[model samples]
Target: MSAIASSTSPQPSSSPGTTRNTNVTILLACLGVFASYLPVVGVAVALPVIQQALDASTAGLQWVTDAFILPTAALLLTCGMLGELYGRKKVYLAGLTLFCAGSLVCLTAPGIVLVCVGQALAGVGAAALLPSTLALISHVCPDRRKRARAIALWTASLGLGLTLGPVVNGVIVEHLSWRWIFLPSLVIGVMIVVVGMAFLKESRASRDPHLDVPGQLLAIVAITGLVYGVIEGGSAGWASPAVIAAFLVAGAAFVAFVVVELRSPCPMLDMRLFGSRAFSGAAFVMTVTLFAQVGLVFALSEYFGLVHHASTLDIGIRLLALNGFTVLLGPLVGRLMNRTGPGLLLVTGLVISGIGALCVCFFHASTDTGTAALVIAVLGVGIALAMAPITTIAMNSLPRRLAGTAGAANSALRQIGSALGPAVFGAVLTDRTLATLPAHLAESGLNPADQGQVGGVVAHVGIQAGAFLRLDTPTATERALSAYGASFTDALHMCALVSGIGMLVAAAVALVLIGVRNRSPHDATPEPATA
Candidate 1:
């Protein structure tokens, strides 16, 4: 119960060093950032392969992805605090070591359970990696201009990871094996460890840091419970005792988290940050944007693999239009923030993305790849416009001393949204497919008794609409495929509506709560903070 006030001490001064030292530091930090995010989207491209190889159910597939996201989101604030209390360099190297170990485990895992365990370990590592990387950049680059450029490069590395993950995984899964997805990450992790040990400096806050253990545990309980409930509710009846109990536990945990954070002498999350409209709005923008982006990628990757029956490489190529634009436009967006301001970019980007998401509502199984590519390209452009600007807004909204915490908070929220995107959208897709299945099956001219015979298969199809198209049974006739396609299209449309509406709502939030007034003269340049 220490009552130490948060301090705003200047960044620790580094020795006057050669330009080579700075470059190497930036390079190593960027590499760590890239490796941390590489697995986020890469796994989506390999989901079908994993599903078949591991005989994973739809829920299992979701868990495979979410297991990583869960710890990354849940432990981020705590990890960031730990980085401040201990040494950023120490926490970062430890994280890389754990990440490498997790990658090795995933590479050699014999079952889906072990794979999930491995992903969870990697997630814990990521929780330690992300904030520390950004904090290190801020610490080493004390000059405002150099710091800005360094942070921008770090942000670009994130986009690069998102962009390259799918395509690289596609190539590996198609040519080598799904297990190879983690191999490159393992190598990169080791390289970062060696380079970081030689070049990175130790940095910590001047204030005595308190680890909010109760708040951290509560966050894990809340997020895990809510996500589990959402994913399971799709299969178990929504009102089933298990789902209901999970939601209840999540609700109670969240309430407890708020209470603990509010009363703690030194909170993990300073709830007061939310009192600022601009800070809250920027966080919301990051959340909803990723909610649409991640969920769309997950759904479309499955559509490409299961519905279009495209190869993994083809799926990656198709997705290039969406992810590529984000990487390309990141720098330009940062430059534009000075002129047009983040508010305009935020609103414009969300609106454009919303339009792109809604456009998918018109897509059918026969939609050409070219048209799909064009639609996703628009989505990518919109995300690019918003992503960097949103980060700028969130970081600038706080005092310079809190930059590390701001980064951690924004990232944690974004990861929560990332976790929710798949769970919520996947639930909608499963439920809509299940609800639409019976009527479609009835219309296919099956007698009630014959339909009853296929009831078990229908349930499986509902769990994964793509599973229906993969079936070779007599029950999976031409009519059945058509019925399943219609059902899937309907479910996708519902998913689109949800994502589209979310973006639009985010746009409204930005318009009302966020403005250009907070934009610093240097376009929200980052200040020095403890790593």
Candidate 2:
């Protein structure tokens, strides 16, 4: 086996200037990660505004979000491989440039289609940026303790972005315009480019491997098709031909992707990485974590807006309970990781988060926001404990040379979960709302004919359940409002149950697969780079 050392392998630097440069590098990488994540949650606050401005349907709003997620999730592995083959700095800069351009396009987008196109462009940029940012950190910080701290900071920056995205966007959309949401991201993108050019050093693999074009294509098709099917299944019946075809295409593409990767000499994602229990377990935990986190974020954002008639600012504030704890506790958790081992943190975190989610299942329209916030804070604590440590464990499981691939694979899986979270949760929420709407309406003392008429309106406007709640018209009757509230509450309960169940399963997986032994800092053992 040929070992190709990464150029980023840490060198001792005692000089003041070198230390300052190292700090700057970490900052720049964190900024890059921050930029990539900002859009993911920030845009949720703006969805209603965009829908109103563009006269977009619920599916259109979903596509606006999914457009970005699809490409980001699909292309992450390819971009990660390219970063190693080309140069990490070069790819990083290019991603920032594209992201800036996409932001500009979104700022000026006249319709939802244009906005979605711009989002897709940004997704492509994020695909390049996410893995490279982590790889750069792994390269610069060699000491396990220092690396863990840096990774914690990196995770915190992501949480900060996720934390700020909604609040900032909410304030902007409320006081200014939805278009201004992209402005800060645009400025940040430009600033990062300048800082990257000045301080970021170039790093790449010692030898370039063959690009896996077929594997890349298959992966993209599979992911895009699956996301499409999930999103469409909510509005278009699950049995609809279009939805069925999307699932079939996704399945076939996934099978083809596996075959191509197994055959390719230099596959984008090495299938063998799953052979390591630690690596596979970490990946599974990540997917499950994001699935629950992102889905709840999406669902609850709508819940706040639709059920409570929360202003954008209020919705953002409500979400802070979940994200704020993540940002605040991330570094502390990182510091403790050496003593705890990831297994304990993972199991403990998932269980706590599951409990939080299960608690939320009891919420109703009249439930106090304080009660919801308290439970969400518990969920946040769980996420903080698990998030950074999982990354550390996954990277440590691989050889130094394959760190880039490891980061990419871990990130790609997380994004896949992120995408699925919203799609599946949204689908379930919509289905539950439709099923329960009639019963709730009838019980509210509406005549049979009136109930039928209200149901038609719900079928049309209720595609975007949250947005439909905001509508002021005939269906906004006292009884109709009550029915919609009850229906949404029912949906929220189901969504929370699903999230809780997923976390429990993840906790079980962590116990079975993650190692309980903590590696000593002095023990420097390298695993073979088989992939």
lDDT of each: 0.76, 0.80
- In lDDT terms, which candidate is top? 2
How accurate locally is residue 245 in candidate 1, as Cα lDDT from 0 to 100? 97
Taking the tens digit of each residue's C-alpha lDDT, what string does model 2 give over 395-506?
Answer: 7766655657777887888888988888788888888888999899889877777677768877776634433433234544666777878888899999999999999898
After superposition, which runs of candidate 2 have C-alpha atoms over 4 Å from their true positions?
A: 1-17, 463-476, 520-531
Model 1 quality (TM-score): 0.89
Tell me model 2's lDDT, rounded to 2 decimals. Answer: 0.80
| TM-scores of all predicted structures | 0.89, 0.92
In candidate 1, residue 311 scores what lDDT?
80
